[model samples]
Target: MTHLLYGDRLHLRPCQIDDLDFLHKLWNDPDIRRFLFDDRIISREEAQSFVDLSIKSFKSGYGLWLFFERQSDLVAGFAGLLDFSQEAPSLIFGTNPLLWGRDYATEAASVVLRYAFDTLKRDRVIADVDEPNAASIRVLEKLGMSPARRTIVNERPLLYYEIRDRVGN
Candidate 1:
């Protein structure tokens, strides 16, 4: 069950229970969790639940997927269009801290965005970034996602960005 989303340097695949350890390690990294989990530590139980949910995303024909560098075979990170049980799906993305500043997020994001629009037939996709995550904001903007609004998410200020399918298809 190798689900692959190929990019120039990434091999995006469906995440599985076996990936809990990797998810735990990456999700707990201080640098990544700072912006990702709102600076809160995710217990193993929580990470397990998260993986379970991602696994379930397959039923909907869309969900989070883990990706690796095509040639290097190194874990690039996870990126996905999570419905998050909301009215509209949101873009969730990340890369290994060691790979930061390499446009991997931007590249992975673009791949997911196309999947959302072209394959999933979504008219738009959105991302919610913590106010202080300037880097994440930049990546969303680089993908042509515009700031849609701001609000209190999880008791913290967050900037919500949105990218609509230009052709209205």
Candidate 2:
């Protein structure tokens, strides 16, 4: 399991089978659902299947990690890298509503971006945010990612943002 630290407010760890309930609850939230996964309501079985798939994928160094609030030790949400294409890998993040506006997403994403660039030694990281998700756009900007392209995914228009690690200062 990989553990990522982000100051004293939040940390990220691997998502375990025990986290299924939390994932179900979070995914059921209308607001949260609207911004992700095509605003669709998912069944428990679907959630389980997703977790199972992610667990398998994690073995290959690509999958989501559970976000946690350090003080409360609660699952805040999830963040990780996704294989968007063989040539371009993207970073993705989702935080519990209770932690929204708290910078948890930004903090965790910053750590993930650093890991992608430093540990994974990736040259760049990209993100596809729904056009209506202004807050996420702000977070991307704050992470130093700029708009790279815009495309439609699953019938939804998405803005693609990217950040590249410069070789030398």
Candidate 3:
């Protein structure tokens, strides 16, 4: 059976094909796409490929996880490690716009970070943020990640932050 992860107020499970609709809607939400996809709409097929990748990633000890509020059983967002084939996995997460400011992103991400470090035994993890996204910067900071570098993607400035597992835990 697939494992379930929990936080103080949320529960997370590996994403599956059945979640395609929810993911597509989340990815296409105007506020979300602006920061996550540079305002471009993700096609249904593209979203399906994402689920497919998650399935493969799970076999490798990491993948996307869908998180839901414990009380409501409502999907608040998604979080997971990405792009580890080429290098260390980078963190990625998003919360429902209506649920913004409640720190759901940070909450979900914190669980994923632990999975990466404590469970998967990764030495470090990183995240890429759009330069103008202060909220995400705050989320990464709250997770104890620090700026690693800066670059441009699609002509937009981007910031890369990283965190390493210290000697203890």
Best by TM-score: 3
1-169 in candidate 2: lDDT tens per residue? 4544464577777677888998988988997889777899999999898778677767766567887888888888888887867766788888888778888888888888877776667888788899999988999999999998898888888998989987621
Candidate 1 residue-wise lDDT, 16-133, digit = tens: 8999999999999998999999888999999999888888877776677888888878888899987764667899999899999889888888988887788778898988899999
Clashes of 2: 0
TM-scores vs. true structure, each candidate: 0.94, 0.89, 0.96
- Candidate 3 structure, TM-score to reference: 0.96
Which residue ranges in model 3 land beyond 4 Å of their true spot? none
Better of 1 and 3 by lDDT: 3
Q: Which candidate is the best by lDDT?
A: 3
Among all windows of ten consecutive residues in candidate 3, which has the lowest summed lDDT? 81-90
Name the 10 consecutive residues with the lowest summed lDDT in model 2.
1-10
Give the alpha-carbon lDDT of every model. Answer: 0.86, 0.81, 0.92
